[model samples]
Target: MTQVKKHEAKLSRAVESIQPSGIRRFFDMASSMENIISLGVGEPDFTTPWSVREASIHSLESGRTSYTANAGLIELREAISDYMEERFDVSYRPEDEVIVTVGASEGIDIALRSVVDPGDDVLIVEPCFVSYAPLVSMAGGQPIPVPTFMKDDFQVTLETLQEKITPKTKAIMLSFPNNPTGGVMGREDLEKLRDFIIEHDLVVLSDEIYAELSYDQEHVSTAAIDGLKERTILISGFSKSFAMTGWRVGYVCAPAAYAAAMLKIHQYAMMCASTMAQYAALEALTNGRQEMEEMITSYRQRRNFFVKSLREAGLSCHTPGGAFYAFPSIKASGLSSEQFAEQLLLEQHVAVVPGHVFGEGGEGHIRCSYAASMAQLEEAVDRIAVFMNTIKKEG
Candidate 1:
């Protein structure tokens, strides 16, 4: 009469507190239907560039297949070091300051793990990449979310950061050219944050995966600010820039002590990323700059087209300064983000991610990826306009 599930009883309370992801519910629905033009995923629509792929194939052809050092191959790490210096004016020693990670995802996980012990509070900017909190929680930290609103261009405020800080806070996780909202924090903005970090004596996890996609201004590294280098973990990768998502290569740059400690975690948990992929990423750093430039240019064109189209469709579109997403309010549509996305998919055959997938603060907003072709974006705009006008007329 009492057959307990094999794993149910032993499951920790920490594991149970996590919920199924909000972003996935919309995805599951969007996927099963045909004629759905998905502007949901943030991935580049392009394939990985030719040169990088060649490097991977070359590695395999030469039988360079084996486990790499847990921190990764030294050659690839050196390439990354040089690339960061040349591109962002950020410098780090290859031997101590960097660790090659599986993706920015792993960099995020290991970075949070390094500083957050049980009950340490992590401050996260709201409407961010959804994974940050769950990763923090899994690593035994609590996330303290600071909400940023549309009126403010969704930028985190110095005042808000000051208000949220407490004695228990360990770190603040930042994502610029951010997910969902597509907001960016320029140099002046990051300087304010750096000053706050020094005053509060806090750690910072800077997720700059979308750094390459900034349209209006240059991507600034938090570590580039003078005093913040020791305290900031810079997370970036080859995914967005070089169309290398499936390659699963990313890295983190921090001080030597942090790198060494994270290497132990990486060794035990992941061992290393794919060796061939690391070789490909090495090629990306050394040779794929032109490809990265071209994609960023295309995204800028797409960003301009889609923002205007979204406004023409009657949604209040905030021009995302970077990244391929436009986060527009669906408040006038009389639908919550989840409802709006479902109806858009069901009626107009367009797929967009509901903004609440990022957090509660995103309830009335929707994230549309403009990485699709021009034709699809036009059709999506037309469909959305009709849907809104019909709803208005009905009311």
Candidate 2:
């Protein structure tokens, strides 16, 4: 009989440090029970609207089901280029600058893997996406978490960037119109980051997947900055805004050389995004703008309700200018973020993610995604308020 070697006893540290998302725990628990209304998920509740779905059906019917070019279909890439230019005022050559990916998920992983050598320092602004740090670690780069201030509305400042920067720094992960906090960084912040990256010659990985979700202002693309365009990799997809998460379509746009380099890695790792999905994404870009507007409008209504009700429920909530999440402080409950989330689930039958699940600066908050229906939100709000009142009385 062969014995397993000690070095191969289990997973590597990189694999081990990359834990499963904390938000999924509630999902597992909820699936076991019926009648559990959850606002914990960070996605649009809408399905891929009819037009986009029809595109995929049409493609499959026409025998467009074969593997596409490793970088993705040219039509989809061109659509992405045109979409970016018309929406965010950013321009890139489709043939050279774009690579279609499995989703923004694959775009992120490939972009990091293509550039990160062992022990390279990657700066991540917190409280950010859970995937960024772990993905960096997986690629053998040291993940450095840079704290974004809640008081400052979770904007990543030049000051924080300066403090976290060192000679080993290779890249910074930017998730604007950010998740969890629902924070949006304006043109000023984008300009500051662009300038700093130029001075340091640092690479910028800007995740604009949530760009279409902004409420109070138009989303800014960091790649729009002059020389910074050469160093920035813009990762976006049709998932969030177009209700196409199940389609698993996204693309990365970068400088031609870098895009080429990343495409090599992506080819080996992913091969190609789903052909039907890419076709669906083409229709999404070509005709999904109206669908996106409808989703955004619904999110804005949901966001307003959640924000107003959350504060009235005794949580100090930030009225986010973008995204469909509310980063409400649960500090008043005298419980840590995890404790607050657990108790809320147990007693109130409501599930929310602990902010600390994202990173260090998120310790005292809970993230509630308002992407659910208004009726579900109202009930959750009532239950949350009653739960808080019960706790306050006990205290």
Candidate 2, poorest ten consecutive residues by summed lDDT: 5-14
- As a whole number from 0 to 100, the lDDT of residue 88 in candidate 1 is 87
**Candidate 1 residue-wise lDDT at 370:** 91
C-alpha displacement of 83 in model 2, angstroms?
0.6
Expressed as tens digits, the lDDT of each residue in 1-395 for candidate 2 is 99986774666877876779887887777667666778788788998889989989999999988999998898888888888999999998999999999989999998998889998999998998889988899899998999987788989988989999999999999998888899888887788777789888899999999998999989988898778888999999888989888888888999998899899998888899999999999998888889799989999998898899999999998788787899999999999998888888888788888899899889999988898999999999999999999989999
Cα lDDT of model 1 by residue, 1-395, tens digit: 99986765668787799988887877888779888888988899989989999999999999989999888899988988988898788999998888999999999999998889999999999999889889999999999989888998999999988898999998999998888888998888888777789988888899999998999999888888889988888999989988999999999998888888888899999999999999999998888989899988988998899899889889998889888899999999998898888888898888888888798888899999998888888888999999899889987
How many pairs of residues collide in each model? 0, 0
Q: What is the C-alpha RMSD of each candidate to the true structure, in Å?
A: 1.7, 1.9
Per-prediction TM-score: 0.97, 0.96
After superposition, the stretches of candidate 1 with alpha carbons farther than 4 Å from their true spots are: 1-9
User: What C-alpha lDDT do the candidate models reach, one value each?
Assistant: 0.90, 0.89
